[model samples]
Target: MMPSLERASHWLALVCRLVAGIALLALLTVTIADVGTRYLHRITDGAIALRVSGSVELVSYLMLFSLLAAMAANVEKSQVVVEAFSHGLSSNLKNRLHGVYLLGFAALGLILFIGLLDSAAAAARHGEVTQDLRLPMGPIYYLAAALSLLLGLRSLIHALLSAVFGADGEVSHGE
Candidate 1:
């Protein structure tokens, strides 16, 4: 890889980590504020009407993004793997296994992409809305689907790099 490309990847990964952390913090803040407002309103017999509607939708979005960020880290560390067969495999066989893993990830990514489309369509048809805030659920599902797709793409890339470069800085899943 060129120096610039490697640097870009590293920067992108760092940004993803930062975004995931911020999102989690936002979720925590929202939850705490909602709870405090609700409690205060009840105690004072005030009409605060603090509702946490659509927050769950936001949670789902943030959760999936956080998951994808974690998955990206796993890919960077080469820490995601199918261990059931890997543990018994010889070094020579591990190379072949990695190739198979790549192919599997490609297929899985395609399948997940299709499923996400279907889910989005279904959500549109049903007009599913979040209970409290009436936020559409489509976006959350799409976010999760996108994360799954990215994970699959990262797996495929990892396999390609491993196959071509032969595990220079690769971190083993076992570690």
Candidate 2:
């Protein structure tokens, strides 16, 4: 891979992480606000109208987008491993297992991509809206679809890179 391409990917991943972190923080803040409002209402009037508008749902979807967008960085760094048994394996076996793992994740990403896209389209067509908040679902669905598609692209790239470079351990020198 060219140096510029690698750098771009790294930058993209970093942007995704930043977006996700901000969305997550927003989600937390919303949750806290909702809780505080509810508590105050309950103490004051004994009946709390938990009237959180579409922002609540918006934050939720944005949070998911942030997570999906950052997936490539996680995979590239091997930070998403369940490595109890793999740590004990021989180098050859570990390489083979890593290949399998990468491929499996790529396949999963593809599935999620297709599914999310379809769901997004359906939401748009049907004009689906959240029940309680009456928020438009199309934007959330579309955002999720976009994020999932990006994740699939990232998984595909990582899988291809791993196949060519050999996924031996945490640190990849790149072939």
Candidate 3:
């Protein structure tokens, strides 16, 4: 890869990681606040209008963003693995198999990315919005599509590296 492209990829990955972290923190905060507000409202006989509107929709979107944003990093680290049947394989075979698996995941990610683009376009055309908050869904879907594309590219790169360099290319966590 060109140095500039490599740097860009690194920055994108970092941004995604940051987004994931923020989403998780926001999700936790929102959950706690929502629960607390509901409890207070119940005990106080509805004296305080502290119940957050559209919280459920917000949380759902946050969870989706968090999961999507973390995909590239997780793929790079080789965190998702199927070990049920591969425990007895030789190291060399295992690495090759994993490379193949990553390639498959890349293909799946590509499909998802394309599908998400179409979904986003359709949502925009229809002016679809969250039921409670009326927040447009198109932009969120576009973001997810972009992240999925990134994940697909990352997975493809990792698969190629693993195929070429054997065990050195893959990040193994002893799982």
lDDT of 1 at 122: 88
Candidate 3 lDDT over 1-175, as tens digits, reads 4333345546667777898899889998889999999999999999986987888988998998899889875675663456887778777776667777789879978998999999999999999987899989899899889888888877776676565455433333223
Candidate 2 residue-wise lDDT, 65-159, digit = tens = 76786675565565345688667767666655565667776687778878877887888899988876887778777766666665655555555
Question: Which residue runs does candidate 1 get wrong by more than 4 Å?
Answer: 1-15, 39-51, 54-57, 78-110, 168-175
Please tell me which predicted candidate would have the highest lDDT against the true structure: 3
What is the C-alpha local distance difference test score of each model? 0.63, 0.65, 0.77
Each candidate: how many clashes? 1, 0, 0
TM-score of each: 0.64, 0.74, 0.82
What is residue 147's positional error in candidate 2, in angstroms?
1.3
Clash total of candidate 2: 0
Query: Which run of 10 residues does model 3 get worst, by summed lDDT?
Result: 166-175
Ranking by lDDT: 3, 2, 1
Q: Roughly what TM-score does model 1 have, to 2 decimal places?
A: 0.64
How far off is residue 88 in model 3, in Å?
Answer: 6.3
Distance from true location, Cα of 171 in model 2, Å: 8.2
lDDT by residue for model 1 (80-124), tens: 467885788776557645655665665676687679868977887
